[model samples]
Target: MLINPTIEQHDEKRRDKMSQVSLTKGYWFFFEHEGNDISMFGSVWNGKENVSFNNEIVSSFRNLNKFKSEHSFSKNGHNYKVCTHMTNMLRGTLVVSLYCDDELLQTETLSQIGKDKPSKRFFSKTFLWFLVFGFAVGMLAGYFNLFG
Candidate 1:
């Protein structure tokens, strides 16, 4: 299986940084099957997903609302499918699999936990808390004004 360096090694600290940078552009998966070069790109923020063979795009679509999506194409009289599954919401983890003729060939996973700072996460939680608090207070004030 042809694998990109960024997608192969997941435990190392340096690879974590590389993954963060790649997220800005999107997640890229490279594979080789039966003498064919296949590449897949999945966006993290948006819902865009694409598949290419020999540098030519074969299938592309946007997936929103659903946690799992699949892309299918045929080469050499065989059907090939690429599936992306979101496994973890908190960690932002996704599992991608490649299948040939309904048989699984390879699998890869991408996560956004690497290089994530605690401060950034804390601020996000704090912001969410304030948003909820403000909403509750607004509701209470409106209720009192109408009742009084």
Candidate 2:
């Protein structure tokens, strides 16, 4: 007797939860291509990227401080490429694209904007300090007649 396994379908809500995690630990991307399970992991902190086909890692590499990185691999005479890009720095948005045989198959984006509150407050506070410091410096310069 043989048992058949069912494939699990991913929804948009799961993707949203994954995006929030991407900014901290790393990113996990899952896709299905021609009945093949394709998964990828990328770490922004360590600059490591890995691509897996059917639970087997096909390509792995490290690229640091890059706005965009691309990894390519071939399996069973077919070529595959995974491209990761930092679309927005402020929002910490990461866009991952998968291609097979030079054709785009799927694209996913991970973003941590309003989801992370501490970092958001930090930016606002920093900007306020910058404005206050600039105003103080300008007043000091005027009082000393430094413009002349």
Query: All candidates' lDDT scores?
Result: 0.71, 0.72
Q: Which runs of model 2 end up more than 4 angstroms from their true locations?
A: 1-20, 114-148
For residues 49-130, could you state the per-residue lDDT of candidate 1 as single tens digits? Answer: 7787665677888987888989998978989998989898666677888899999998888765545545466457657867
Return the top candidate by TM-score: 1
Candidate 1 — what's its lDDT? 0.71
lDDT of 2 by residue, 1-148 (tens): 1111111244435434333343445677777788777777777567787777765777778878788988898987889998989889787678899999999989988665545456766467657867998999999999998997
Clashing pairs in 2: none
Candidate 2 similarity to native, TM-score: 0.62
Predicted structure 2: lDDT: 0.72
Best by lDDT: 2
